[model samples]
Target chain A: MTLIQFLAIGLTILILLKTISDFKKNRINLLAFLFWTGLWSSVIIVAALPQITMPLAKISGLERGIDVVVYFAIVFIFFLLFKIIAKLEKIEYEITQIVRKNALQKQNNRPQKKI
Target chain B: MTKLIVIIPAYNEAKTIGNVIQGVKKYTDNIIVIDDGSKDNTYQTALQSGAKVYRHQINRGLGGALGTGIEAALLNDGDIIVTLDADGQHNPNEIPNLIKPIIKGKADIVIGSRFLKNQSMPFFRRLGNYFFNLMTFIFFGIYTTDSQSGMRAFNKKVAQNLKIYTNKMEVSSEIIKQVRANQFRLKETHIKAIYTPYSLAKGQGFFVGLKTLGKLLILKLTQ
Candidate 1:
């Protein structure tokens, strides 16, 4: 297979994995999926294409396959971190809303009683 | 005005619980000292110090002790709750610093950080703290200089929802993770940490940190 074909297959696999995650989490958003899929595809293409890949790799002083894999792993981990943070933020907001509403209801339900 | 209750988790600190309890008297009369199932005279010393003491009947680790202490404090009318180590490493004179942020309505929880300033700590101890702080920051984006500090203050609302299940030293990580998840306002204050040779050697070893992270990962995955 050609380098471009390998890049295409790898990018497609990453997109499929991400899509599976989004589906499992029930967070389907067309624009976000398209953006991430395109981003990863470009990254794979940029790393796999021989003509541009070697020169860029030499210029940046990064080894061929290992450096690319390392960079990809780092970026993937950061993306996962942000996704976790977003989920935590959502939960925090929901909890705060429920607590506030509960407090308000309790305050309203209080009656004037002789102490 | 928020009423404050000091929860001192004493574990065989009979030699020091008396001074610790007496030390906190000027600040607040409401204090709960959990004897943590100490085999020594911990309960007797605490009672002599004029604190309402409760016995756990068995050793429940520091986290469990703190949980029991918080519950007792709340039942005793705690509006703001502070947890202090009974080993005397924590200076009760600095109690006000721990609780001031809550009083100012700025933070729901305030943690006393030993490394927040130029406090003297052992070499290995400092290195361990730096490592854990980095791990915590990388995982949660919440950078606390001293994640293992024993002095902490929490308001009533936070105190109510503070469920600590990690019955050991790992509870420190669990505490920060919960704080981040709950989005509670956090404030760190520079406080002095008195570390004797004994206390320095008592710090968690490297394997303990790794085990704590492993437990944390398992809990996260299971949850």
Candidate 2:
């Protein structure tokens, strides 16, 4: 096996172990745990047997097996980034609502000044 | 007599907030200053100026502050609500003109347009306003001479129906969008802008304007 393949396999195994640990600690839900496990396991398979991606590359009209993986990785990363942005926006909106409610409640409790 | 409540959303405007409150006091006794987590003494100054003050513990930007101010005004039984900048750029004396349409049952929302009177504004600022006006029209299919005007008067019904979702300078555009969506009667009146070094130093810059446009686009997509 090539040095790159050895390193890729090792890194993916470490990531998969971490994902399992997170699932065990209830840090991620079953769906999330399954997603990460499937993703990393595929990465391990692709790294260990580069020939397995040949059919995927041919069907996707890519020149090489690695090209198929790279394209998928790029698209997946973009999807994750979009999800993160939407989640952050929702969190910000919620925070503003809480702050507004607190400010109004505090103001209401104060002595009413003749306006 | 309509109970007019003036809401001034201020952030670090201690220098001018007191004067702004006092100016608005000439028009209406119901003045509300939303100190959007100012690190200064804006709250105390507004209070000392005899205006009701509500303060956010952390800054939530212009939209958030306006939302709070509108809710507070509605709670206090305000018949009409006016929003003015705390930077003292908006003339409180002209506030009577702004609310006149609402009182006369003509307009549900009146925007104080600086462009209507041929007032002298910085060339770039005018150009920027035109650009944002076009953007507002493009995004929400609503056109206005001054989509970014800080001074606006709306009746209690409009205030209760309006929803401010953004928390930044883009709130100006969002307000225009909401007016279009709710099909409220809108009017524009000429009002002179008081330009001072301090006031000029506070509003949206070129980059902030671009950011506002970007946020407005996102708002359109998400909502």
- Which prediction has the highest DockQ against the true structure? 2
lDDT of candidate 2 over B14-128, digit per residue (tens): 9999899888878888998899999998988988999889999999999999999999999889999999999999989999899999999999999999888688888889999
TM-score, model 1 to reference = 0.64
Mind giving the per-residue lDDT tens digits that candidate 2 earns over A1-115?
9999999999999999999999999999999998899999999999998998898888988888889898989999988887786777778789999999999999878855956
RMSD of 2: 1.7
Chain B TM-score, one value per candidate, order as shown: 0.92, 0.98
- Per-candidate DockQ vs. reference: 0.02, 0.71
Distance from true location, Cα of A40 in model 1, Å:
46
What ranges in model 1 sit over 4 Å off?
A: A1-115
Cα error, residue A98 of model 1, in Å, equals 29
True contacts kept of each: 0.00, 0.76
Clashing pairs in 1: none
For model 1 the local lDDT of residue B23 reads 86
Instruction: Single out the weakest 10-residue window by summed lDDT for candidate 2 chain A.
Output: A106-115
Compose the digit string of candidate 1's lDDT tens values, residues B1-223: 6788898887788877888888898898777787767899998898778777766666656766777677666666689998888877878889898888899999999999998788767777788888878776666567898887788999998888877655667667668877988999999998897776545544577887776666556445434
